[model samples]
Target chain A: MTPVARLSPDEERDLVVAAELGDHEARRRLVEACLPAIVALAGTFRRTSRIERRELVQEGIAGLLLATRRFDPSLGTPFWAYASYWVRKAMQELVADLARPVALSDRAVRVLATVRAARADHLRQHGAEPTTEELSRSTGLPQAQIERLQAAERTPHSLEERVDQDGVAVATVGERIADPQAEWAFDDVLDDIEVGEVRALTDLLDDRERLVIRQHFGLDEPAQTLRGIATGLGVTAERVRQIEAGALAKLRASLARPAVAVPNET
Target chain B: MEPQGTALRHDALVYDSGDEWVELGAAFLRRGLEAGEGGVVAHTRQGLSLMREALGADASEVRFVDVSAAYTRPVRTLASYHAVYAEQLRRTPSLRAVADVQFGPDPGEWDLWTGYEAAFNRSFSHLPAWVLCTYATGSLPEAVREGVWRTHPGVVSGGTWTRSALFEEPERLLRGSSAARRPMQVLRPLPVVDGVEQFRELLARELVAERMPSARVLDMLLATSEVFVNAEQHGGGVVSIRVGRADGRFACEIVDRGAGFDDPLAGYLAPRPGVGAGLWVARQLTWCIDFFTSADGFTARIVM
Candidate 1:
């Protein structure tokens, strides 16, 4: 937070020379002169909290001091421009360090980075985007990892975000997510049928016959096509369809017999 | 910048991981120390922490600076290094420094930084310093890594340093990128508001009305949403988005009015601890991801 002195070019050069010679006070003042750039550089890295921002600023100060010590006025570059790189470097390094532990190898991170750059370059260079094959060739990373890395890098969207301004939802991506058991149970179309009718079928048909009719028609499932029922029962799908038709016919005849038949049917 | 009468030695080393980098750093430091030359390592926390652990007692002797300092801009980085070497050489005629920008292949960022690496050749054409620009190949794109060879006159890999036959001076290589590129066939581009919901609705309607493949629609949805978030987060104002079929594939372009990304991987790199994958997922689902930034702002073209 120290104020940097506004020195003339010659005087600043002198201060820079002194600072480079291990002169602590001169170095401190030189660092002060670069603080504005340091603070600005610190702002570039995104921080989650006040503490982390402060930490990044502290790191920038470290860079400022290094730049002061390393600054060679003989090179004719102004102090701040020379110092900003170190400032940015320090802050970015901190951000990189504070990075979450990645499940990927450092190399994979590098390769992913490479693939991204190549694609961008290809995009910019050519108005057209590059295919994975082009990226694989350009980036020299394997296509498989390249594909995976690209997939992993996109920002996730809340399926909830897909609605229109008027709240019309074309569809949702996350609706696919739900409790399996609840999904399975709530998915049961059989629940729509009366238990009495279910029981009537239970008594009217043999076990396999009732099971095939329900399963084929998707009474128990959200909707298992007849083909799925046949596969599950290890029968031809056509045969399952025939059984389903026969079962429905029998049920119709049984129901037609009226209320007096219910007790006797069981 | 003051002119250096002496020709500078610019070299690049490519490595895959922290361990390889540490080995290179250790040797770089040893050579400088043994030869009685000033030694400095511009370390980012990524490798510095590991290098610190690896060097044990030896970590203290080297003059360490942050790699970020030189990275805010390419020219600034070179100027900083110029100062660093110029200062180091005040004690002695020759010095050796190891610095890593740790530039992973970034989309917009790499294109910007390549010029920086290219500039190094001329920036230090005079100082009698061995500037080892370290690149972690583990993270770089092949083209960007290939760029390292073009920038540096020398290349070191697998324990041997050799003159790079691939080296091309910046003048020859740093030309207009668009010259070689063929423009894509774009349909009637649609004006889009910055709002995500509107963007989604427009995109969905277009895809569905076109009877775009369901899988393609999903990819387009994710890509558009991802790019929309990027434009909102990084760019501002009215954004432009459009969807069309090109080369028998569904394609989209999302353009924003910001200066664009400083790092090409800006959208992909998880800045916060718990942030979700951003553009990376968008790129993954799509057949292609491309980006460009200029005075107009940033634009992304994606196809699937």
Candidate 2:
């Protein structure tokens, strides 16, 4: 492996200045020069998993790129000094992501769902939502332990559970009655049981639609221009507009439902 | 003795005042350099422009020492800068005494200044003498007064008023001051699932309102949303959000109710394949990002 060469402070500053001024070559040079420092910093986390090292380095590189573009030479400091914070922060985030589980086991996910249902049922049976303390008392678990367990489950409880409302049902909680806009947004992505609304929104669209939506909404890529998306999609710019409108309409229709029926009516 | 000798020879001693003093100190340092005698000055890019005009054509080599102040104590920044400067001085036999200037006039300000002074004084006591100057002029002291007033504006108006106004005009001190703004907006507790969307919307609105470029704001919103979503999916949807401005920067925080990982630093050090992009997206989006997760919860903050 070739050893990474460290740029002198002035060279680094020059690269940063040029990069900030939209000089592509200088931006590339800045990334190349800082790559070694980033790698060495990544090395310090040797105890981390191999996955973490790769992620941290990549994150560090991204940070270095951003630092280059945003770095103002007028600030009177070397680019490296300003870049260090972003680099380390990127590295730390990589470590944190690794430590966090990306995909829960199917069984664990099911268990969480069941636990949430059971908790809600227990609250309904008792005529009041069980407090963490009460749940701990009834379940014979430490409060902290219960809290931890609950977090792992990620079950969202409704506001009604906390109040003394007996007539409200779980299905009613999911009803499309109260706020039409929220309900429409919620319904548009509710079809896929496995994924939540946001993820479902992604799944609902075709690749072109998804990319356009993501770019236009600034979801995935940096902001996109209408012309850019239109060119990418091989459609007229007006067609791009039609596509967006069509997608939003479909989403709204899929997610929207008639207002809830009044109780005991039909 | 060798370490002491090295400390004495350095042209200047640099200290990290954390984010707290970087701006004020940089301003002071720029002024000092502008009154130049070919003195070498080093700081972050944010502080560099002010000193550029002061850099003489025949100025001695000016080296910038890059250091992290996030999650570091003010004393730590000072200590690390001192170490770097001392080492450099040791290498240069020709350089004479180091000039150290203390800035700002906050109450605890003395603690950091005095500590640095004591360390340098003790370390370089045996060497040839150098001047240690302190500046609390204009906005430097104004920042300190603002900090005090935010907490105790009444007391400041009473006895401390006269002392605070001496450094700068009272109206200039108070006008367009960050102290007038609320310190932090305490958001209602949000579930990790729904809260992430709400937080993203709020961040988007703020970014648009502030006229931050669309690309930058979008990047931050996406990265933050991902973190919050992960908190809900893995940590049990326990999360909180807070936003505020401090020290001339905008900050947003996303806290999750989850025991921090067994090795908090390990995740960033070694991430699972293909998942590294989320963090990369985050880093690309913000000027500074900090993460703190413990047995109880995780807090990720972004500064722009």
Candidate 3:
């Protein structure tokens, strides 16, 4: 590892002045000194996309050079703070050029991180997964938004993608054991909860909802199409789809609860 | 191909029963197919199967597209359908379609789908096509049901086709429907600036402070800059700019001194190279760009 050059406040000011005054050696030294910090800054801006760390660092360096020409020490804004703005802007523009299909906003990423933290805390305290409502209340995100965020977090993984456990590769994602009971996995909303808890959640739903949820996900029964479910329930397929959506929402709301108060049967 | 004398007949068929929809849809397509008009059907799997059963021997005449797969993006879908319509019109003077769009589940997605429906009226107006958009009111949300009435100029129901009494003009309906949505929560007023660069910096500070990703912030900045330039060039210059947060989405409202353009479909069509490219870019970058007029002035509110 290369030792990063650290300059004190006055020294940094002198270096900036020297670099700005056509001192090639001083500019080279300044670039070398800021290299480590630039790399670290690039790390935070890293995305899951194909844009590389090296490319981002190059963009940051371009910004640093621009800052060297533009910065006025008399402005009283610290060199690091002023440079950081230019650095971020350059990298941001590069990413935006490549980000035609915009990734989730930083707020969404932070919210998801907060939800994970809250979920961990809930599991630590309660010894079970938290319901969407509990997570929403704890994180201050709306439940609907929480559900949507969770869905968005799922980037489609290749079947060959490795599943890791505590930094160790365990198995491929496709190699995971499937529950024999569910022909069509009830994997969208209530996948995190255990089967027993799922049953408890479903118990809180009315007869129609229970039927819809069961038939839609093929819980213990053969997976039936929405059209088939609609015929069996004596309703339109669209109505069946709506009932299934409502039932899943109900299940998501009631998940991990000790005892859910069932709604009055319609 | 020569331009068809008649405009596209866009109608909504709001039905509760599956069997009835299949019957009406089959009849609509069969008549066209038998008359040597081109036929296309894009619908949910269930709708397709039911329609196929109803059409029986005649089902082979029409092209089938899976609605779930095809209707993923509004802009792309419009482009694809435009191509299909252009190709069909070379051989047949008229085309008929059963377009039972599978609307997305969330509000943002719903906006895209509804916007596509409204934009379709203008995009396909010159094509000799009859599109029947089916809405299963049995399970559809009230907002979507209302969107159906607003977007479609006519309705076909109970074996009768009639002009919808509730049908507002497409541009009016799109603008009104968007304006009718819950007002964004304006947390604070952002400074109105003269040049695009200053406005960009100001908006960037607000969005970055809200922790939006930089790329997204850039897209918003570029888009807002486009609108800012448009304001200067046409809308008598921007008067005020306000930033707001609503349902975890960021909204920037730019109020201008000029009356907003009357064309509702103005930034909607995928712009022809030299045409209104700025607003088109703005519309592409943001979730939506809703234009409104008030006693104060005309406002273009962008949500991302």
Candidate 4:
């Protein structure tokens, strides 16, 4: 590994001017001085992406060279600052091409935005988030398209942060009460088998998911707010809402139908 | 210091034949059951059947779980296994298990599986459990084969357990495995965001201009905001934020000039009170978040 050569700020600005005036040695020197920083930048990407560190370094150098020719000192930004963008951009372009599948077309992005705007409008009007069916109806998009848009945007949520609806994180009305003693009136005569079935269903969720659900419902402790759940889970209140939504969605889907259904309100 | 208990002893069992797998698995469990420790066997259907046959009446003493069913998602699997380990330990002083990991068919997915294998060491190292992960040597990719050697601390062969020289520390191995190595699309650059409001408005505008769908854009906004704010607070200061279209999805890399870290498990750990969960939130809201460190500083690349 080469010990990266450094230049004083004024000296670096001078080299940029000289290099732009077609000084080959000046340009070469500039690239050398920035090599270590570029390598270090590439190292950040090395652990997480599929692109090789060596290739990234080479790409960074290419960016630095381009910076030398195109940098305009009149803009008054540091040369390395301007050059580092090109370096990072170059590597990112390569990753975009080889690493990921076509993520979304400009058209797809537009369509999704349209659907989301419609959903937001519905939420504002109805004071609740809209379903895909409602969104499709209002947005004039096909249900399949809306569903696909939703599915494609499903991020890999950590157990503590599962976003379901348009980014709202959260729980039921009873769980929303600020006071622990303010118990809402509801039936508590569900059988042991029903309880066991719910347990089994909840078991399918990860630990944090289960924790969020339990905390929200006051299963073992007092019913808590989204903020309380977040603090307990060591996440943001917004993230807690998302996890609660996701968990409830999972539970609802599981409970909707089974050969032996739990008795509901008669 | 190590925890005061039967500390975890994780080993890899690389075998070629079905008979060898059953013989080794039954012997491993028998040795544990004889000492009154609980035994569990998580394997494919065939492996379970063979183990049951080999153990005869002893099979009734062991718990059998279909690996095909249990090993679906890496994080979920870890959580489920954690639950199982906790439950088993409550009934006995120690626990032993045969884990036949099913590394899926797609070669692209091997990294996560290998990561799971390596991560298991940190997640379960304190438990009083002995886990022998079996791998079919014939089917594994060369990279996966190397990963197996690197992730596990011990190797079990010919009914004997020996320390593996190839074993690397989990953090080091995961860092090496997590390095990005593929081609992605180009991202457009965003001007330096001066503050939180500016950052949000600029990033949202960029995504809107790119025609990113609203839900994903919302996610990207929340996720990227967290990364950018983190850079400002902890990363000395923000250098620049680069955003562009990659493979149809939007990508952003927030660069900062700070003394970068090398720990792979940084944000993955459960967050503590008063500690920031920004990285963890960013990780959850994107398709992937890859951390890069170089002499230049650090970059948190978020892809959605």
Candidate 5:
């Protein structure tokens, strides 16, 4: 393992000064020194098909580089702290760029227009959507072009509707409509447990105990079986079951020693 | 925040390096925050950490679930996501989630994950959300990447996405999945009712003996029966059924003498007053089901 170089605050400012003055070695060293922090800040963002963690690192380095160039030691803030926000924003900006939907070129749209006319003609004549081969034959374009047009003919789905969709069923249905089972299950689990008891149920338990109890009883997802919970937690199924038992024991013991009177005398 | 208003898009991104990995995750969370839709991220430990920091102050608004910490079984991951996502939807009207659960080192998991991706098209369809289901480019081999294009409607690359020209419906993708192919115990053609019953009995007996989960066996039985019903009703009464084990799942193909139905969404649309929901039901219950029709005849194939 290589020993990490630590720079004194003054040394860091000197490196920044050298980097800003177009000193290549200093720039490289500065970027290298901040690489881990840059990676961590960049790690704050994500990767898409166009870029990956490397790109975020690159983008972070870009931010760090820009910050290096822009930083004035007079500000007195450490370069690392100063660069962190920029490093984060750089990745976030890239993320914003990647989240966008694809736009078709005008030529493709024009080709699509001609293809649609042909498809409509084919449909009129044959009473069915034309296959890529058939559309190619009718439109005088290549089979690939026709297929591209066919794909483009469909409306471009905006991701914004991820939440705007009022008709959840219509949006979700590709083949079979999934059954709606959440609200009922949730209500069933916590419906009777008063707000006070909800906290009281877990007040004595640790985090793992709380999670295991909730998951074991299907308080979150469909009641995950012990094996299911085990898989998620990367533990043995037996371990998950044991944790659930211990948590239950604690809860039962707590409930048995009731300091508060029974609610509603149920 | 709010995605630039294109609608109903399914995009796939194949990233060459780690930097690209978080691209979709960032977009998903950022857009969710922009629109107040709420972001949910299910990813590996490394991925979750990156995303949480990326999310920053907005991170609290988002619900981040570590898939590595949670999902134990690949087959169960989709159902688990479904149940969990459905649970989240109850709290908010819409959501955008990045489900980056990791699988592999064992190529065998390829088929299971593929089936989950295909099943998810319908399972998560109505949730009023966009989910970017990611796979690393370096890890998943070419054979594994085979049906990846078909399951998704588009591909995201180079900071832009395009409609996947090769995108095939999930059913067809599953049917054509190279991973799903294996030596079949081909059975002779059988007539309706009596023959179908015999085939079911054999499948039930064999699947149980093979130590397949009993509930899964029953589910496959129901899906297979639906196809048989369709074959008998739509095509001529005679049909042949082939069963085999491929990629850790029981796969079966039913062939009928009818010309292929080209409408990929055929039985999936709303049921007519008289016509039954056979194919639709088959889709719901199976791990993966696809419809293929050619001159030889239409074949309804399923993997469970």
Candidate 6:
């Protein structure tokens, strides 16, 4: 058996810092150290489904990564205490997903909608609250049925589409987008773009035009208006507008013309 | 606590013939005397004699009334006599009929006692009020008993044992209390399988669909497959499996048509145990396990 050496407090902190800075080995070590805790939290929801265990573990790992990124050493609380809330919330989401189907029957949804509508109407007209019995009688449904519907109204189902083929249910989005094959196909399409066509477009734009366009649209938040773009570029709104218009015209004209076929493909 | 009434020294006894009409009448009198209140007893001469033998000297105080003579009297005269006797008894207000055999007690008292007795017997026996009433009225002939037993096998077999009777009321019995009975749901038998893999897969699918807990569902599947495997390897090739849920628990039973084992657990747990690992695993997984084996075959139940 390999004797495991325990890390000192300073060493642990350094490892966490290194992992957050994108050190693969440090990240792997951190995950190994935290796997048991994550698995235990996931096991709390074992009464739900086994598939939920793997999913919750993955979710916990994601939360752990996020916590590492956002961790503040100045905060008095330990890292585990800070990450506990995220881990619990992930597990709760898994349990909620498991309980969704039985808790949200169709009849219940309709009954709830009807009751909400009736309550709104009653508040508008009578200005007095209606009793549960009165509501049940008014709805022409039994009190028991109404109570079941009320309980069902509280739980919600996940919105992801699932396809069941040959008795195996799988998520369509996960299968399509998360697979390596799909990533390869996407890369292939990007690769097929003509390099000369791209160079011609780059040549058509000056440095200022390229920077404005890239900062405005290619980054997370697009520039809201011409003025915002000009402010970022340290230029006049008119100059920013001229650059944007010229960049757009060049791209449009290039797209309108035929693509230069790569000889290697033939 | 009310003040204690004086204890009356009295004894009334009853006997049964094939008819046993007179013994029932005497028994009614005994109950009344024991209660420190008097009541009538209507009986034939032969029944009265049997009661006399049973009670000995205590029988001496009993005022015997011949129902045969009452029947022979003119209807109008008898009716008038009955009314007068009833009124006279009310006025006297003693333990009036304790050691006596008479046609009936005072009309109001008769109605009250019979109704009270009906409620008492129903609660005591956990049988229906109608059955108690029929017994009290001496109307439960063999034919009536057979009919009732046939119609309601559960009642006949005494499944509804009344653990408490203090809270029972005549009104509740008359209203037909449904709470006294447990609700049972029946399900069709599932096809028997040779291995646990298929059963586990089915259970896993059901669990993922939120039909049941994965552990309990897996436990039931494993337990059921264990029983089936027992039947296949030892008893025969395969048997039948039936599954259902009751009282928030799942249950499955496997039944087979083959020679039974001497001791079910012993055979399963003995040396060179064949397919016993399955049974052991099932036991660990399930909450309760039971087996019934006879010369005919075996039936095992696993509750989870």
**Per-prediction DockQ:** 0.04, 0.01, 0.01, 0.01, 0.01, 0.01
Estimate, for each residue in B45-82, the C-alpha lDDT of model 4 and write its tens digit: 45665686578657667877765445544544665566
Q: Which stretches of candidate 3 lie over 4 Å from their true place?
A: A1-266, B1-6, B14-16, B30-37, B52-63, B69-94, B101-123, B137-153, B163-166, B171-222, B240-246, B261-281, B293-297
Q: Compared with the true structure, what per-residue lDDT tens digits does model 2 show for residues A1-266?
A: 21222665555555565454334455556666666676677767644222434445656765665455445444455567667767776676555534444355575466446556657878789877778877765655455445544644454444223322576444433232233222222222222311221124346667777676566655534546668888887888788767865664454333221112223656
Please provide, for model 6 over B78-181, each residue's C-alpha lDDT reduced to its tens digit, 9 standing for 90 to 100.
23223333433343333333222222221222222223322322221211011111122242344333322222212211223222323334444323321222
User: For candidate 5, lDDT tens digit of each residue in A153-259?
Assistant: 55543322242247553441212212212111222212232221213345678999877755654342344666888888999988987786676456434322221
On DockQ, the candidate that comes out on top is 1
Using all chains and alpha carbons, the TM-scores for the candidates as numbered come to 0.34, 0.26, 0.44, 0.45, 0.39, 0.21
Tens-digit lDDT track of model 1 for B1-304 = 2222244678888887777888887778776766666677787656765665455445545566756434543443554565566567666557777888645222444655676677566545545677788888766787788888888888888768889998875655555332232235565578776476456556766766655533344446656676787778777754666667654345677778787654333332211223344554564445446676644457777765
List iRMS (one decimal) for every candidate. Answer: 31.3, 21.2, 26.6, 20.7, 25.2, 43.6
Q: What TM-score is obtained for chain B in each of the predicted models?
A: 0.54, 0.35, 0.67, 0.69, 0.59, 0.33
TM-score of 6: 0.21
lDDT value, candidate 6, whole model: 0.43
Which segments of candidate 6 are over 4 A away from where they belong? A1-5, A21-25, A105-266, B1-304
lDDT of 3 by residue, B89-113 (tens): 6567788988887664344446557
Cα displacement (Å) at residue B299, model 6? 85
Please give the distance, in angstroms, between residue A19's alpha carbon in candidate 6 and its true position after superposition: 3.8
Error of 6 at B118 (Å): 76
lDDT of 5 at A38: 62
Please provide, for model 1 over A1-266, each residue's C-alpha lDDT reduced to its tens digit, 9 standing for 90 to 100.
22344677677766665554334455556655655555566657754322244456667766665565445444456666666766676776676655534355576578777887898899899989899999988976556457656644655454344534466766544344342223323212222311211132346778878677444333333335667878988999888777865764564333222111122345
- lDDT string, candidate 5, B53-99, tens digits: 45654666777675542332333355456555655655655677777
What does the lDDT read for residue B247 in candidate 3? 34
Winning candidate number (lDDT) = 3
Whose TM-score is greatest here? Answer: 4
Model 2 / residue B105 / CA error / Å:
26
Q: Of the true interface contacts, what fraction does each candidate have?
A: 0.09, 0.00, 0.00, 0.00, 0.00, 0.00
Candidate 3's displacement at residue A210, Å, is: 51
